[model samples]
Target chain A: MIDLRELYQEVILDHNRQPRNFRVPEHPQRQAEGYNPLCGDKITVYVHVDQGQIRDVSFKGAGCAISQASASLMTEAVLGKSLAEARSLFEGFHHLLTDEGSGPSTGGDLGKLEVFSGVREYPMRVKCATLAWHTLKSALEDESATVSTESPNPTPSGGP
Target chain B: MVKTEATLVAPSLDPGLLRPDFPALDQKIHGHPLVYLDNAATTQKPTAVLRALDRYYRRDCSNVHRGVHTLSQRSTASYESARGIVQRFLGSSSDREIVFVRGATEGINLVARSFLGPRLEPGDEVLVTAMEHHANIVPWQLVCKAAGARLRVLPMDDRGELRLEELGKVLTERTRLLAAVHVSNALGTVNPVEELVAAARQRGVPVLLDGAQAVPHKAVNVEALGCDFYVFSGHKAFGPTGIGVLWGRREHLETMEPYQGGGDMIVTVGFEGSTFREPPARFEAGTPNIAGAIGLGAALEYLEELGLPQIEAYEAELLSYATQRIGSLPGIRLIGTARRKAGVLSFVVEGVHPHDVGTILDQRGVAVRVGHHCAQPVMAHFGVPATVRASFAFYNTRFEVDALEQGLREVKEIFGP
Candidate 1:
């Protein structure tokens, strides 16, 4: 059984307390809203791309500690990365949270994102941890539709 | 003004003795003894209910109303007997008044489509309380939308009590029917159904009471309440799922059309059309959950044997104990503080989202419901995205409340200031 301490780490708690880039960027080029109807978690991800590089990334939402902290950490991780790199990071983070076999050590270049490996133990909370990344993916793809986690077939525009 | 100790009022039935009746309550989750507090969602079944289901499937398993064999006769007898139990449970005059549907949702839908749907005119309105479960609200919205009628809401106060003073203003000539929840699932406010029914009757408007949250914790007599229809889910009352009671007045059920077309609902078949059966049979349009009904009957019998009045008294003290204990905690804000409530306690911890509180609680084997509770409007009214709800059952004890309190403190500790 996964301990509560593992899931609610000091780092995750700190990010939740003072979420970094916790606002919509000025004149955001790409933005999308994500919602998890299960828990009523809502998140909007804003991204500004400059010359194939993410100039800024930010989010604003109301959710549990996992979702808010994940969003905060995501902004910090993908701030300066290229679009492809950011998508890859989302993939790696998703793998870390979903694949039980994929531990923190196995998550390549995940850095602080690996702290969420504990979330995999609580299957219900995986969606909470991944809501931000899914929203970020939608924002990156410039999807106009609001992403919902309950969507049956989630494509590039699909939510967590 | 919080009382640290249990109230002076003694519980008629001791929960300690009754706890053994429910086998599910005797287990552990995550190494800690299970503290199941999510009773409003669904209750754990007692041994009696379980035995009824087992006995039905094991020995007297057969289809009802059409079977001529001994097994079929037995099954049919049991099924109809369950209806009689429900009729008596609701204090309805006849078994024909009790129509067994899937659950409270289906019961409301049946009324919306069959009874209220056809009577609604272009400008007619259906008045519902603001604190109703979505099961009550959405069906009316659907029926109203299709019939070009309007759906009006009777608002509630900050305490989650309905604004009874505005009832006269809200009930206009255009109001075709008044539907309300007897007890709120999210907020534990017990609406004054008697007064609401009297007011509606004065205007010659019919009333439907959603008793899903009301039936489990208290005694509900549909006739006494004077509502046109009283609907409730069986599962919430320690019965089986997929079985519920929709008790309507004889006059209304006699005239209302059948909600569905299938076997066991028809008296005769013809090429073009068929003649339908009377009241209860007209509404139950399928094979009908035979075993589920028997199980539900046994569950209701169990409650009756335990005595609803005693159960109510016991639960009242339990709720008071819980309120005083949880309410006194620092940073804990009780969402629903209605003067009169039953089984539910909704709250939000300071600077902590409800989901986090729920997760931490679950880890400590204190099961709670956290979210909009299918009542997003209630959450909206309270200016919250969601709330952590710790509902009670008669079998629940103060020991479990202590576990919940301890778990909540751990949540505050983890998410430190």
Candidate 2:
């Protein structure tokens, strides 16, 4: 059995150590920030969409290893998928982290997001891991313009 | 005769020799040596306190004051004896002045309700420091609203030290009370309670000190400081939870009304109207935490034997060493720089959020408190939402400080320069 203390596996820490696409886009379509001020977890989600398919994705900010690694992994999972598919994964990951479902394996194609199932046991860290997804969801909604690391208020739509 | 100071004549207590007293210190965390640094929040109970907890429940368990049975008598004796021990520890005038509440929060709330409720008038102002824990802040809000009193703040500098000049300006003829922390749990700045109380006393305004952080770290005398009220939690002082002490002046305790209506707190209850018990009994209304009280008393005895002065001397060295090491790290910004402090370091590394620093530290088996620490006012003052706080205890050593430094260094190497 995996030691409970080593809750974040070596792979997750490695991803956090060398985060993937941890930069703002050279030119971006929509940018949104996600913050969990209680734990001081902050992240900026940047997205690029062309028609229905996600053209590119990137993120920047700092938080716990779970959050940074989850953002890295999230970028890899959602890069080529449609906006609808990305939303579905976000929902599926939320369900997995909150332990609301019977482990979303056969139904929702959560991809590498399934590696985060162990996060449920440590409820405090769940917010750390989900910070990125919340940021990504803001970008997908086509509403929020700037993501703040200070406030938890969900961003209003991109429109006036 | 002058009361003898415990640590003044006592020799230094070795943390190594004392390590075995606490059972939890022996455990490992994250494949490394467990370095528990979160003591300002609460301390790990020593074996003596643990034994007291068990012995009371297993052997001497019974209702107090009411029963004539042997168990009840034994339990009552132990409970009252514990109160006497706490009374002496706090330099209280008498045991009757010490009332056990839930914790420091409840203690502050009790005074705000019982004492402040009767005297405060409309437009009278209650002064609180910007560094107050939500516990200290929220209770005064209730009292202020009830009496139509205004609540003002004693501002602080960047280091979270109370603005004494602001305090002088704030305390006027209209000021009723000045309630502030003896030590900031988030920042580790130790307030000069003597100076603070002296200023308030000049204007005849009462001062209530939140001594939650001060009691465990150093010697505290209510009379010497000349504060009207002092409060703290048992868990923070190496005792069991669910029990705390509130020490108020005798006159105030006698004048204040009873907090709750129940069994032991009543002298005589009538069908026409209820007659309340006097002073402390009037305030404490219910079956108290008998075993917890016994544990608290034992905890005090343990501290006495170890000698608080030696503990203070040893912890001061630890704080200095830790402060120096933390100050040298690249991109690490220390938040509070008060001339005097307890054992807390609240800081955030550049390009890294406080949560990230906390997680990184946890990976190395160093436990610390992260986030606002229930002091959002301080956070707001700093213009940040939270901070990563590493609070030390008397038992913590330089090795733990080294481990924390190494952990942060690893975070720096991983994230950026």
Candidate 3:
């Protein structure tokens, strides 16, 4: 029996109810739109990068609790990290949610984002958990690129 | 505070007589009995339809319209007889008007390419309603693009019904064809298609009704509807997939060129040119889905035996029962509440995404279609990205509707305060 606990933890639910950084940053340096066509979950990630270090990041969108909470938690995790560190964190977070055979990298730096480790249980929702991260990746690489989960590989240049 | 199943099981619409005919209904999902409310997508096939498919492949499996062999003759007879069944089912004057296609999507594409494409000139408009499924919308758009014509959309009111008064504003002398859905798949709003057809006819504009969602729920007579073309998927009507009927006026079928050129469509092929078969055969290129057509014929037969009037009456009860049951739930806002609607309950729960609702409902073994439902314009009209659609079939019961209510409560509990 697949546990709903693995999909919707209290921490994730809390973030969903009261998401932080859930606004489009005013005077943002970079912004990109992420669209999940399957469930019509649309998230736009805005980042302010200063001297190769991530200064501030925010997102605004309508989506499922998992996606909204993931974005909320993601913005907090990548706020103070450098661009390179942010990219590594994205990779680690993505691996934790998608890489089923390999154990989750939730112990180290993911911290509050580790609440999403349970997302791996539902394969269909992996896209929801990663939608905000993809938009953030696109924002870091090209501010204008629209990231869609429909496109298997959207703009190869979308990573640090 | 949802009532338990024992308490909730009051006297209401039950599948009863027709439930046993469909084997798929008697199954378990996740650990609970499956309550399939996603009939808008596709219906569970009946035993008769399944048996027809098996009987065709086991006994009379051969390429249709050719060969002196016994099996070939039997296959050809069965295929042609299925066409006759479709003709009688639609109340079409002639069997020649019915052309077999992949599904409604392919049927619309065929008409758009063959009938409408050649006739359309630059600045000519194909008037479509806002509530059309992508099948009805995209094909016309493609034809319009190809023929240098504009695709004009007829607006819908807030209640999800088409603004009939606005139809005259859009229907001009330049309007070549009017394609609209008989029933909105996403909203369940039954369009006043007969009136719409009459209005279009007054302007000398031909009409095509996307009966994909209508045919299964209600009795659709193309002759009475007075539409130039009527298309529907077999799967949606309890038949097999990969088979659909496109019934067109005899005049249009004769005048329009074939959509595709292949072996069966053509009568004779020379180095210079090839002469095609008349009407139905002209459009049905290559070997058709022989088994699928036969199965569809059986499905039509099954529905006929059950009686459309009885099914319609029972389903109306189910729809109203579902509407009230689902609507009464806290934080659950019903999307489509048109004056006239079929058995579809589209809604959004407060503070819960439709996908989350779908997941929670799925865990409770109740199936429903969520998201834009291939009617993004309808979604745009409602100003919601998506909605959870619980569409009903005649086989659906009041008990199933109650189960949907209880499931929604579970969703509310998970996401509520």
Candidate 4:
């Protein structure tokens, strides 16, 4: 057993079990179905944008513990933030996952999301943890409407 | 009659027994027994195969077929003996019928390039099944594109089985080649190649079967199947990698040009022109994979001793048990449940991603393949996308099936039932 104290620390599993703003709003404006085709992970990210701010946010889908938990936590983090600020948060989180130099001021410390830092050691699971964040970005910026919760594009076998 | 402890007497392979055969299986992953269900991806080599590899390198290391020394002659004799064994294994009438290539991937490419590629004229059609591994499909696509021949795909039914009815409609006089899988890697659908071949022969169309997945699981007699060409990988059948067999009829071999040209294939190298050797030797260009061929030959000998029929029966029982157990699990959906199938169980848990399923199972020390399985078209056919595939070999047991079920239960617990 990968020590739960290390891998699925309470904060992470708590978010997974009872995600924040998990239900679709009674009246939502735009929705996109983001899919990660690799592992058949799907998340329907609903965005309620008003004026300049991403006022209300929610997600509904089936995914891994990391994916569901990260998505649940993402909605809580980005609520009431401006569209520009949400994109900035995405940059910070992306850096943490990719382990690029420009990680957050918290460094490798992912806060309540710290449990997922162990996932960096596992390059494959990094996607499971980041699947939601990718979809949220698509839902906010792209008008394509339906985003795929499918696994992020790995290097295609035959490079196009 | 079912075998019980007392009836079984010796009890055959034991918990501690089979464990020693696979070195990697002994190691703990997340504190559990490593149940290898990813045999379809590649099999873990047994002690016999490992030793064959070591013995080859340690004792009889020499370039084959051209050595004048005793060691060279021994190596050449053993190498040809290996080819002879492969020839017998496939029930080919002559040893010259077998051609050694890198692996199944290279074998398919060889046939596509040399045999089919040369003869295919403009407007001729090459028919391939939708359930084919990308190996079988992509190479032919390359041939068709270059030869100005059109590619026509034979669609699969909802169960992921080949649409045999639709096949009759497609096999026209224009159909110069008919290529299909003996067994589908992704779907586990065992295609009826004999019937397909019989129909294709009537139209004067040559048939090539992608028998990579089928060859390892059950008994195969190329003579019985009567296909023009049959290809399989040594690695998948518990042998060394970098080795595969491409068996063709003598007439076909004579007509087909060499796939590659370099050292061993040519008899003479004039400044202006070159003359090639005959048949199998002509096709086997460059310094051939001596060790791989030997290892594959040894692997066939092992299988012959084990009896393919016994392996098939044992695997079928395991497959049925796992299928039923997996079927009973709540929220579990088996992807390809064809009536005529091999021992592959592909599924998706409703609330859990396959990576999560894989990760959790990895924690439980159960290994399964999670991907499109290089059959994206089949994935598209199902419409649900990627699936977690638990492919079994003869070595697996019912206890492992129980463990898989337990792993799924844990998955249901993690994601919540």
Top-scoring candidate (TM-score)? 1
DockQ of all predictions against the true structure, Cα-based: 0.55, 0.25, 0.41, 0.35
lDDT tens string, model 4, B1-417?
Answer: 112222233223333444476676667677887799988878777777777777778888899888799878877887899999899888899999999998888888988998889888999999998888888889999999998998888888888777788887788888989999898888888888898999999888999988888888778899999999999999889888889999999999888888998889998999999998888998898878888888888888877766666666666667888889987899999898777778689888886667677877877889988877888888888876577899988788888889999989987776566
Over A1-160, each residue of candidate 1 has an lDDT whose tens digit, in order, gives 5589999999999999999999977787899999988788999999998999999989998998999999999999998999989988988898888887755666469999888888888988888998899898888888988888888654342110
Better of 1 and 3 by TM-score: 1
Error of 1 at B391 (Å): 0.4
Off by over 4 Å in 3: A106-108, A152-160, B1-14
Candidate 1 lDDT over B303-415, as tens digits, reads 99988877888788888889989999999999988888999999999999998998899989999999888898999999999899999999999999999999999998999
Weakest 10 consecutive residues, lDDT, candidate 1 chain B?
B1-10
The Cα local distance difference test for each model comes to 0.90, 0.83, 0.88, 0.80
DockQ score, prediction 4:
0.35
Residue-by-residue lDDT tens digits, candidate 3, B273-301: 99999998999989999999999999998
Q: Give iRMSD, candidate 1.
A: 4.4
lDDT of 2 at B305: 81
What tens-digit string does per-residue lDDT give for candidate 2 at B1-417?
111243366566678888899999998776888889889878999999999989998999998988999999999999999999999999988999999988899999999998897889999999998888888999999989988999998899997788888776888899999898999988888988899899999999899999999889888889898999999999999999999999999988898888877988887788988888887888878899888889999999998887778777778778888888988888878888888887788887876667667766776788888788888889888877677788888888889899999989977765555
Question: In lDDT terms, which candidate is top?
Answer: 1
Cα lDDT tens digits, model 4, A80-107, are: 9899878777766766666744434444
- Model 1 TM-score relative to the real fold: 0.97
Q: What is the Cα-based TM-score of model 2?
A: 0.84
